[model samples]
Target: MTGGDEPAPARVQAKVGAAVLAGIGPRGAEGTDGARPHSDGGAGARSRSEETVDVRFPFEGTVGLWELLDDMAAAPRLVVGDERVRAFLVDVGRRLRAPEVARRHPELASLGFFLRRSELERAAGPLPGAAGSLPGAAGSLPGAAGSLPGAAGVGGAGEFVRVPRGLVFHVAPANVDTVFVYSWALSALMGNRNVVRLSARAGGTAQAILTIMRDALDDADPVVARTQRIVSYGHPRPGARRIPVEPPHKQLEHASPGHHASSDHHQGEHSGKPPRTSPVTHPEPVAPADAGSGGAAGPTAVLSAACDLRVIWGGDRTVNEIRRHPLAPHARDLTFPDRSSFAVIRARAWLEATPATRETVADGFAIDAYWFDQAACSSPGTVFWVGSPIECAMARDGFAACLAEAVARRGWTVDTAMAVEKRVAAYGLAADGVADAVEFHGNVLAQVILTSPGAAPRRWLGTGTFAHARIGSLDELADVVRRKDQTLTHFGFDRDELAGLARALGGRGVDRIVPIGNALGFHRVWDGVDLPAELSRVITVQ
Candidate 1:
């Protein structure tokens, strides 16, 4: 597809339809039959549906879970050295850098930059003579968690060499299509076989990334390339369900799922009361995974039983469903259940901002919230402004106007359902005496400034809708902090002081307090979990 003087293809990329899944391989007859759910997982497991999934590979092919897993079983585990992994991602970065290619998948463009040669080398830990770029090198962000009681030097000083967990299963969320790459890339770096279950509603961004990856790896890099598989199936919900998450690590054994079937919040934040608005009501009372099976949990159960590590990306409900399927005793899991995030700005900082500077700040915030249309857990759902009453009022109007313009510039897409949802949330908050004023970006988005924090938990909705509250001081934020509050983006705030506050004034909340602009910057150590470390085992040879 290049010009006359172009070089030969780097690797042969094939295009095949979804039916190609049939020809890859047959189900293994070993005790681990790829066709059915595990014995322990059959409690709530349902029969496999007769309909086929519309899954496909970008280089052009469709494959089923069994065939893909069989293909991987045939490949040996790769001993992924830092340089080789860096080389692979660099190649991928090069392809994404092409303007034509970059134009089509805008959502993934920034993600590609993280895999650039420079960023890859930096993230690989201390090079021969180079300094570490990120605070924790490869594990976590620099914060007080490092100094917590017995947690010092956890990933800091060690003699143990890391080894891959062998096979990784990723149940990616429907919200962000590109999230699978981050988890899959970490596992791949440790030389694991990966079967990623993307949302059945996955978009072109997912397909494009796989295409670049295939072309970059080709036949030459079988170690990394041959071990990867991407597939999706309709996530089943037999009876309208409410799910429970299995506690992580060794705790999975002692705990039963149904014990807290009535607990509404997964991370257990703001347990005051179910907001007057319930997203949807369950038709049937569903027991959490371990408690009872709803007889419709099939795909998740089958996939969970087959892998060594399962990285789930959906809301807690989805995680609760998947964990019900059960896992091999030796397998460990890390789940990124749903969490809420927000931003905090000092009124003095905003009041002092120049017109041009204000727009830049608005542009940055827009990027954070607009990337996934504020659907990501890291996206700021609320903005709490701390300052004098007069400064607070001005700050809200100025920032809202600037933010509205910036978001409009990005060509935000929101359907009629969401448009109505925002309006309802906006007016509902006003009626509930939660918001004093509301702003709109035409009919597509709404920004509500709350006079009281009460309505935020009750009516907070995302998809370009924002709710902000006025606070007299920073100390008030702690009262507003809920366990599920994830990221705190700030403008004109002290990172170290806030980090210390998160530790000293903690309510089991706020894992990350990043600069306003970088709230969405991917952290290798997310939710206090060292992903690379969690997916691998460390063996100490004395």
Candidate 2:
């Protein structure tokens, strides 16, 4: 059976070393992990004896649940201690950081770094989100992680206890398979049981990671295993729908970063239209609400209803659609909705770079663009080269060539569909006079178009689709910035210039600005929020 209909009968079997005992085909009763008969010493002992349950795998198949979950009622059954959580992350990091592991699984590279004990310490620094401010305050300020009026660590902030939000539901994106792990890590650290919903179109990476997690975590810490459930089942079609780029023929403009164009009815300035007037494009692909209800409403309904925190990641449309559904009164929502990002390279810097420097820049930028095939939210889709039209073009073209070579050496596979899409979009823009010229690499390499500032689009450019625009100076970018413009990958620019740009945007522009090649690096404080702090509740003892 494809699952999702009803709970099946319990299965029992003994496990032998690293071998998969096949399921007994539909309610036939099959396998076991050597669980003893559990008893509560009550009249309900018979019902409580069978604790293991079959849970659907987040990628392709299903696994028994015998784990803990909070159905939005009482507290979570299993509580993972901080030490246990840290140990699990360490184990995952050790495995992922292995040379052979990295060679076979490049997708999990960032996860390794993120889970590294030393790295995690640096990112957390004793207390990850301990600020002398109230919760929900200071969110407007960039890098301003909100925290209670105390610190949390081995010796400090003892009065302030970070309480888990019970159960967290993670709806991870398909393009980046490891994202779910990143999201889950924070909640797990806070001792929250999690149920991550991977994309129905999950790649093999999800399965591979899950298998390793199963092997390493089984019985090592019952709290870790029994508290978390990584699940995936058929979700509605993706590509068939998308977060709309703009509303019909209207083109919304952005002024400097310090200021915003206000429209009372506008949904988001980035989308280029007022919400009331903008059309909802994707409606057929509903979220998985209640599979137990026989495909009623949305498959996520049951999960959402039972969860205390819902971390939604996908596109803007998905975020908005999910918001339409109500959450538990005590629940909270954090969404990594559709966002666009770009890179800003100083032409003089690139043009004046020594041969070795140029090659290194190419390699770094290549990592940013090529990793995740540019499908990640952090990947820069448009590059604004700051310099004269002639010089900028020269720098852009040179960088493209160097990047192509690097990508080939790295053996980066281009998404054929996205490549074709880039070609059509570039040529289409040129034909419409929006782009001055079109650049296409038949090598399945990359595409960069020469266009005016703000002419570069956020959507439509998938994997290899890149856009370029000439800017006379840094100030020109202010007019082209959007509300959702996330990362500003730059080179040849000093701290002052970048800070000035951030100030000019009034803190409404890029939430993160990194060196040219570090665009895709994950941060503990992402999208302008302290994740660990935001995911947990800080009770002020005072």
Candidate 3:
């Protein structure tokens, strides 16, 4: 996929191997061996596991999970707002924005924008100094200087420094390929040593991301790789048979680390496998709190118990499953659980909008819903029209026309299998008497007019399916809002109006209420957590 004569995959593999091995040890001030004293006073180092993880970034190899943690612990300490980490992340972002790369994977373009040097600086918010506080960053960020309690370090009475939270272990979702990057980057930017566990089923966009990161490492300070790792390991599901473990060295001999664009699956696209008809009640088997190395839970238990913080990104089941592996007394958990979102439009405003404006809104909404196949937690599952009955009906019709045109323009389509699923879901909604009218515009768009605003479906109804309803006013939506609701993307709503609705809900649901197009945008503060502040601890001196 490279413009170069060398095959992209082979070129990436060779470059990563050479650059990583060369700087594997701590250099310059820390020590020749690249090992720094464990900041946890050796307790973190003592929790080693023979279980191995397949290192995907910085290098491609299998190393014992505990050994990998030890390497991270041995690396030089990174202060909050570390320059080396910023420079490396900025370089990676720039490359991600390259015309060729962005054109190939448009989603990466958004990710690249999030990683821009300007964005990073804004997220770091002038560091710990005279400023001593963060400005309100984009996307409802917390404007606090310090949040986490003192983990270590001290200064003169009333003077203190913000320090890394030490080791952070991230368990990324099997779906959503690029999300792990945002989580890991935020932690790394805070100067914490981070280990991101990428799923084995992670799509090709993830592989491309790893390759790009490896390429950036050539110019990065050795400490960048020493303190950060992105690895993938197999964790068996409940009732699955155990596979024999292979020795690390033997596995490395055949390991391949490179771009695999040909294998790229659209992020959030359903695997060809049949969809599950019911919610998974049984937790995925994980190691018990005391499980030793070599079993499914071994790695999870060790990483969970050893890390200073654990970030879990997935559905409710995932959160419950990971919770089975206990963390240390001092460690904490930041979780993103199952969430539903919707779009809100003032019916009269939508109807009054000029054709061009309506078209633009439709286009933006299409990108948000279609990009992730309407399955992402932020993707709008329903459209709530606010107005009198007559205006609402007219506006809904206009919106359906515009949205149909927009979907066609983007050429978003579902396969025969998914199309069947969408039809089944739409009919099921009608049979349940929640849908008053069901309409389909080819396989790319389906609209269900809900019998009432309270009947809006929160669960996904296949890609491009939208359950729409009308309410007399924005205030009426409060009764319909549920705790599982997350993002509320709006068009033609003033800040005061949206904020009032949020206040009315009273933190019952909907953590993010943004413009329609920005549903997928990554923010430093997500799901009500101020990441930069949460990832670092503030030490105050008496």
- Scored by TM-score, the top model is 3
The lDDT per prediction is 0.59, 0.59, 0.71
Cα-based TM-score, every candidate: 0.72, 0.73, 0.79
lDDT score for residue 316 of model 3? 82
lDDT of 1: 0.59
Compose the digit string of candidate 1's lDDT tens values, residues 1-542: 54443222111001111111112112223122233333422111222211222333322233433444445556665653334555676777777777656555555566778777666545543223323222233331211011112222554443344456777888777666678887777676656777777665554465566656655654234445456666655544223132222211112233343322221212132122111121321111112221212332234444555578888787777767666555655777798987888888999998898988888889889877767667778889888888988898888888888888776676655667667877886788788777788888775458787778644552237467888788887777877787788888988777676866687655568888887778778766688665665766554432
Model 2 local distance difference test score: 0.59
Over 4 Å off in model 3, which ranges? 1-49, 126-157, 235-297
Which has the greatest lDDT? 3
Identify the superior model by lDDT, candidate 1 or candidate 2: 2
